[model samples]
Target: MPDPQSLDECVSIQQWLQREHLPLASPRPPAAVHVSLYCVGKSARIPEGVIAAARQAGTAIEACQFELVFDHIITFLLPQDNAIVLAGNGGRELWQLHVQIAIEMHRLGADANLNPNFQPHTTLLYDKDVVPRIALRRPVVLAAREFVLLHNRRGQADYEELGRWPLHARG
Candidate 1:
């Protein structure tokens, strides 16, 4: 562990994981590279006001915020493919709050799709023959103040983020 960046060091760690019999997921495909505004909760129907807020927010960010470019693919297991319509980095506290919000929205019959355990990630590559061979290094904080509502295609369909909104500011 003294010099963790060496190739030998990296191979040793990979060997350890193999010896431990941990299940590693298959790598994703390169064609899957995409940008998205992950779905949030399903409220029987989206509220007109919420949709308006999202559109306004998208316009604001596009005008003022620097667009972020990413090279990762991520997935969150949800019951339905298109339930939630927004995604954001809530930090620890805000993420917790986001989950609670989804739960509450569900309890109130909001039809929102809530991830059981939401861990935000950006994918870098999809492996076709073998699973990715590297562990993720935590990324530096980036500007992501809002999540967007994406038009849901089928489970295997390509989703596009239509609009975004600012994260409710932390008090």
Candidate 2:
């Protein structure tokens, strides 16, 4: 089989489908890449003030216009539950950091369901089946300053920045 990590060649037929352009998908944004950080739960709604703060921070710090997208619904295990989302050998390390942030967010009382153990990911393409599992390292670096709140629609969750904080090298 072809190496999945290889950048020069297609890893498999599945990877090709993932890359193919889709009509229903949101067009990629120019500023920060859109990524899912945590699940805040149905009951835990983002306060309007928090959303305002994040919007201000995102534009002020990043120097770009920000908008929210209610595009996808995803799931991931948390470390608190003795379950972790690992990005396999070929998985991205950023994802690991996201999980850590989720745990921290949970500790801060954002919402039990949405806090720690957030499985970070972005909606690239839609699919009906469960996502393939991958290995990843723990305690990845993430910025606490940058976060958005999104509204839930059906099973799909939309994302919007709720607040922004600077991430130091230590975090």
Off by over 4 Å in 1: 1-90, 130-133, 136-138, 152-158, 168-171
Model 2: per-residue lDDT, tens digit, 88-122? 22133344434454444445544334333334444
lDDT of 1 by residue, 9-114 (tens): 3233334433443234332222332233234434445566555544443444321222232222233444433111112343454345345445544555554445
- Candidate 1, position 170, lDDT: 43
Q: lDDT value for candidate 1?
A: 0.38
111: Cα error in model 2, Å: 3.6
Best candidate, lDDT: 1
